[model samples]
Target chain A: MPIYGVALLAGCTLVGLFVGDLIGAAMGLEANVGGVGIAMLLLLALTNLPGRDVGPASPSGAGVQFWSLMYIPIIVAMAAKQNVAAAVSGGAMAITAGTLAVLAGFALVPLLSHLARGGGQRGERRDD
Target chain B: MIDVARFADANGLLVAFVFVGLVMLVSAVLARQVGRGRVHASAIAIALGLVLAWAAGVDTGGKNGVADYPLLAGVGVLGGAMFRDFAIVATAFGARVTDLRAAGLAGALSILIGVVLSFAAGAAVAIGFGVTDPAEIATIGAGAATYIVGPVTGASLGVSSSIISLSIAAGLVKAVLVMVATPLIARRIGLDNPASAMVYGGLMGTTSGVTGGLAATDPKLVPYGAMTSTFYTGLGCLMAPSVLYLVVKALV
Candidate 1:
């Protein structure tokens, strides 16, 4: 968790990413595999912390701030490097698709899931 | 034409998501022990998450214009200091919400829902723009994994850490136009659990993703488990590819 180590990890992640990109050119699977590896690494970073609270949940607002602040430079750098206006042109439509899907999930999925359990509930009643 | 480490950067949101989750989860225990004082674990989690982000450079570079390094892994261990019984009233009874199993189930369900949607949004951008950059792929992959990692890691490492950046600006833009905004889709809908709310992910994907890390360690929220597993993931998967397509389209 030291700064030096964090630097080292970030560097390694970039190196790994670069290597994977290059390798992916020859064989399409490299990026896919490496990407998954990266995903796993991210998952491993925080969620793996040991301890479980099966209680009412709460999260710190400050934690979200520091993390976002730290990472903003990276995003801005990416945007600034590009034709920012161009890249953002269709960003709205894309987000729209996702928004729709989520809404559908809440509206339709919840109802369907409940209906699926209708028989399950009846069976439970019989057992009771 | 040159792609940055976009995937790696995006995937990095996992750390932030999990770390928030760990802090909240720990506080949940404390909430029980201290008799319900700091139950705003989300508030505490946001604070701690921001600190972790700063420590890791998960967000903007410091005034020095360099990335920050991530730490706070050890800080997560303090979660154990809190050990107390928690009480959860069923948000809704019967089949709709799976019987409340663990606080984590709620987080996980929400996290998974958030991830799947993010993936879709990314895919849509990709397809809409025809982007096949390694950076974009990496970004989408990271998005997919961010939500589910906390449960995976919490088994060993302890509390979640920090994963962040990217979505804040986008969220800000959306916040400005909530009525016409994509994230506002949640607002259009009626009452429900706000944890898995898409707007939360949009405005604060990093925070929600990091907090969502609780899915792994805590008992699956059996009551809402149906929504968590089937709905969140089901919809999440469906949405990711489309979003990816959109990302590609935008880039192209």
Candidate 2:
């Protein structure tokens, strides 16, 4: 049953890669763009379709759920693939970019939270 | 006994899985006992993985890290772009459209704003550092979006592996900071309710960090935050390579 999920994922990945390649070509780039992201969107759309019985309780859904939870292992594999030594030796650019991004995220949290409250109030008022 | 090295080489993928599993097991324990459950096990595992990879790179004098060894050659395939993409795409099944709707307009906007702002921050830093290449800048910017997004964008852009690794490192640093800082600043940020948690998750955009932080702040809010953070990663992945990359190219 999990194999079925893997099969579905494979199909989605293939189609996603093809489309991504096409988009890249259209953009005049030589690389595939967002293939994995596209495949994910397809999977999300398909699994969440109305009247779909493939919720996490079902067999095929279980297969999908299994891999979803297995993100840790997969990520671990991905992490192992990194050459941190080389990345560090490359320069301080990586650290600077990473630190600034996080600091920026933290700095804007209050602004975003304020925006969310405004939107929430508007939604609540509309509902009433 | 019977050519164990040869056997490991023959079943490289399985061996790699087993090796990573062992590392994860240790990481899980460290996260609990040492990190006090504040840090997610995956974070610890990633740090360990990086250390091991660096050590392997130093020892083997190979660019591929541990995979440079014949016995661990399967690590290359397992951690290659194909399997990485497969695993990432599979995570989509966990999200439901209904959940996204539940987060409301604010939640949706947060994801959009979060991804763009994060990208901008990363790109600004890249530019400040004298990196002029658009693809490299975009890849690093995407890394600011999330670790997953960084590598995905990098691979899509066909950037160098070192740049991809840097993006990943950037993401890891962000994740760790979010995890550590969330609880400390929860009260100041009014992060008590489900609504605020969702917004915070969207803003943070790291699933593990948001979930772990919310769990530490208030276990009841984990799911709400994690849900939006999931969408954040998804949105970042979609936008970083194509839209964000183009924007960076035009600007630079």
Once superposed on the true structure, which residue ranges of model 1 sit more than 4 Å away at CA?
Answer: A11-68, A85-128, B1-252
lDDT: which candidate is best? 2
- The Cα local distance difference test for each model comes to 0.31, 0.82
Provide chain B TM-scores across all predictions: 0.31, 0.96
Name model 2 segments beyond 4 Å from true: A119-128
lDDT of each residue in B1-252, candidate 1, tens digit only: 533345434444454345444555765665456524322333333333333434433244431111232232222222211100000001101112222223243344454545555454534443455545434432333333222211111111121121112222222222122222322333333213433332233222333221232122122322233333323322322233234323433554
For each candidate, the DockQ is: 0.06, 0.61
**For candidate 1, what is the DockQ-based docking class?**
incorrect
**What's candidate 2's i-RMS value?**
1.7
Tens digit per residue, CA lDDT, model 2, A1-128: 66777788788888988888898899898878767778888888877778867777888877777777777787777778677668877447766766676667666666666666674554443211
Error of 1 at B74 (Å): 34
Clashing pairs in 2: none
